[model samples]
Target chain A: MTIDASMRDALLGAVPSLRAFAISLSGNVDRADDLVQETLVRALSHIDSFQPGTNLNAWLFTILRNLFHSEYRKRRREVEDADGVYAARLSTQPEQGARLDLEDFKTALARLPPDQREVLLLVGASGFSYEEAAEICQCAVGTIKSRVNRARTRLAQLLAVESVDDLGPDDQTRAALQATG
Target chain B: MAQKRAREVAEDVVPGHVPPAPPRLDRNAQARLGEQLRAMYDDLLQQPIPDRFIDLLKDLDDIEKGKSTGKGTTG
Candidate 1:
């Protein structure tokens, strides 16, 4: 298929999820934006390869995931240093950090290993099935499942979200954030 | 050498203790975590798409008009 109006819209529609997934992987908004931008550029230029009537969102996700890995490889050490600093900052945060704030959620998400975070976001957040996530991630489905399990376990631990009460009243986690301040 | 042999024999005779596993989330905890994950992701999804991206898509039409097919690698 080639670039058409609907296809362009499809690409646009996929951007927010792509950016969210990118942030989950890179843990920095700036780098995540750049990753999404590059994914868009590649997807637009190579629109011919995209099969119409297939899953456009998954295709875009695969593109972004691949780009992230390649770029992540080249900057692994540099990225790890930045992560060390970020982790240190998180360590010093207050105990009430588990109060269901989006910032708290993001901080906990950042602590996850990128692979684990990627699978977690793919399956848990982005609504990809295990098989779809495996395909996007180019791994076995079982790998995706295991990573999701480990990622959630680690994330919950970091957030100190022990029970439903930790999620706050009425099961409204985000609502709790609004209620707090 | 005698002390070392004695220590080795003593250690070798004792059974190793297995460490306890970390507590995994029960179903309720997992469900709540799922809610939190979706909340975080939905929050991002709901945020306004930045102008840079909107403009980039608009500019893509110009680039697409100039090309018959894509070539070369991303910059």
Candidate 2:
């Protein structure tokens, strides 16, 4: 099926967020890019299967997730970089505590099992609702919720975070936290 | 140390006895973690899309347009 301009435009719009999810999932920029490229190609080829007027981002994400599991996961053992190689590559300006916190968060996130991490990223970071994340992960909504809860708990334990105050002083972070709290 | 503590906690619980529930994050703590998660995600979102990705999209567009037709063309 021919990919129309509007569909192409939507695919372009989704790239950044899709890349973000890929990096967070794979923890490698090069691998994430490959995954994004693969996802876009797969989505375009399967355009007929994609239902219009639904969440394109989620559809693209599902494609990426499936690709990661089926294709990338097998090759991971062969090409996996040492843990923290990608995290170390991030250029954080000196004395930037927020960036440091993000680095720490990434480390903790990488420690979670892929299943838990996927749920956390979808429900916690990417702002997908439980139902939406469940649909993407092909699991029950309750399973997604519980996985998110476990992921948060595991992250807090890993980071040694005792209180909300320990999360740093970013106003947006505080506001988002409070809203969810 | 955390792993050891977890192991200790597990060891202390008898088979038939329900141990006290593990400490759960309070609402405030949960919110804080959520905030941090969002912040990290936001930082990731700010990363520039590499030129290669843009180029790939263009290539896909071209192929879809029947400009360059081949089965094994993609890299």
- Give me the candidate number with maximum DockQ: 2
Cα miss at A104, model 2 (Å)? 1.5
RMSD to truth, every model: 10.7, 7.7
Candidate 2 lDDT tens digits, B1-64: 6974454345444344443434677766676687778877887798887887778778877866
**Runs in model 2 with CA error above 4 Å?**
A76-98, A164-181, B1-23, B62-75
lDDT of 2 by residue, A90-150 (tens): 4332447657777787778888877889888887777778888878988765556556767
Please provide TM-scores, in order, for all candidate models, with all chains considered together: 0.73, 0.74
